[model samples]
Target: MSAAFEIFLQGTPGLEEALAEEARATGFAKAEAVPGGATLQGQWTTVWRANLKLRGAGAVLARIGGFPASHLSQLDKRSRAFPWGDVLRPGVPVKVEMSTSAKSKIYHAGAAQERIERALSESFGATIDPEATVVLKTRIQRDYVQFSVDTSGESLHKRGHKPAVGKAPMRETLAALFLRQAGFTGEEPVLDPMCGSGTFLIEAGEMAAGLWPGRDRRFAFEDLATFKPDLYARIRSEAPQPRPLEELPGLFGSDRNAGAIEMAGRNAEAAGLGGAVTLAHRAVSDLERPAGPPGLVIVNPPYGARIGDRKQLFSLYGRLGAVLKERFGGWRAAIVTSDGGLARATGLPILPPGPPVAHGGLTVKLYQTAALR
Candidate 1:
């Protein structure tokens, strides 16, 4: 068993605490929200579980070892002495990346990367690849350097299931966090009226079914030397079967574009949620409250879109508010948009927007509304 180490869960700027809540809910040990991300101490298996169970983490890093080095030669010596065999393999290709602050003695990132590369090459017999599956990251702040391994090969948002995507697609990680922010657990139904590519519906459906987001993806940890095949096999095999679609609450989505509706279905099928989610082509004004009970309405609409005329969206927001007020009574709504003016245009009594989130070069905020009358 690998020793317990600090595992960092990278989250979106404004949504770090939400990811920490998810980590705590998923039973990660010592999960705490940090400035840029979340951190927890865990063994190797915990790393695997974080990749599998954490829906809100953008990336996961495993803290290796590092030392204080004032110069390149000292860095090389210390890095070579570091036990690369403990976590990383000898032959596995790696990419060394470093970020040095102005307060650090090693001011040149390139020079620091070169020293780390040489250490890996001489001691670990590892080849450096620009596009390697394993990433070795170094963070130098005020002469203190911490080395970490990117345990998530790609961003956690790239679940490797959805090939078809719509314009301004909401990342799966963001969608999951946003769902949590809206107070929707697996028990409640969810609807995304402007469900381009069905991100919200699919994420909700997976949550309701107890599906693992990382089940379909390969993690970088699989390439490490510390990986135990039998232990990992047991872990992977322990994946719980998803609840039958009929047993869960409704997870619905709709879009005006027929193409988006079709693509959404394909994405759902790829995610093993074809039966769990129901996406259709319909405008917001045509949305009907799903029968049985009121749930949550979550939508990510275009606010400062470049392709569409911005003026046309006001009428669209107005119609969305009108439909929800008249038909979707007793349901809560969460809207994400870059423009507060457009959010207010919805005419729903949405609460004041929260901390601005950096998304696609724009700062967006979530506007939450109480249950409609």
Candidate 2:
């Protein structure tokens, strides 16, 4: 645990590069984007810092140790021999989850998981609970078995601040990544005209104020054997103090539903952005440019896929586009939707869409526009 090991920052499937960029910006110098996440080398302290600071990572996984196991017996023997004491504390509840590939001789994931769970229970004197907060993820691929611990107990998107979520509300992780993808560096105003539960604007406010996303929450790493309370306390205390919200750029959101507006307001307040963010109960057609330099106008409007009629949405999108064209000149826009037809209805001179992002059982894409003229 003292030595540097691979730390995987699990990211949104299509937003791994954005997560990597964020990791590098946050001083993880060797962060590199891979298929599922970004990988970097770090010790236990790095894992703690990652859980505390990384906004885009869904979970922080520490790759503790692994070995090759071509057969079930080999897997059991190796699992028992793994230094679980160095990571898992005795009597602490743990869950073992496994995934296997066709190329691996240990193709039965359940069997592999049972073997590992038995090893933890019998060899390491650990408690195996299916409902445990701490998770030990095992992957068997191409005859290689890899063991990683999910240090972020819940998905990082939970953020633990927003208890009021609207229908099809965007995850905080996706919102942060989308904000980054839209070139938002927290230097200017951000308005989500269709803001549901205020995720985008609150995240923007938090970013601008230099608040750590995980400050208000606990991580699964704290339950691991390697966690050092004093070291983690130092790391928490070392984080930059939040800048006064008034000194930062404005963050605004509006929704046609009054309930949504109220929900966003409450969520913003919970995130310590109550005074910073402006939430209004208004329609997109009522959205007006704020009195300031142009910034990002990002929206995750309803698409026909899950909520509304497809034909009716075109008109809504068309109106939204017209409003932006007329009122939000010089502001860049990013629209997220599953339907290209709905996005095209905006007629905002969109650049090519980014890679598809999975959200709420739909494959959505971000259609961004250059600064609107």
TM-score to native of every candidate shown? 0.97, 0.98
Question: TM-score for model 1?
Answer: 0.97
Give the deviation of candidate 1 from the true structure as CA RMSD: 1.3
Model 1 poorest ten-residue lDDT run: 301-310
Best by lDDT: 2
Model 2 scores a TM of 0.98
Best by TM-score: 2
Please give the RMSD to the true structure for each candidate, in Å. 1.3, 1.0
lDDT for position 191 in model 2: 91
Candidate 1 lDDT, tens digit per residue, 1-119? Answer: 65778999999999888889999998884799997789999888898889988999988999987789887788888988988898888788999888999998888999889988998
Q: Which stretches in model 1 have alpha-carbon errors above 4 Å?
A: 305-307
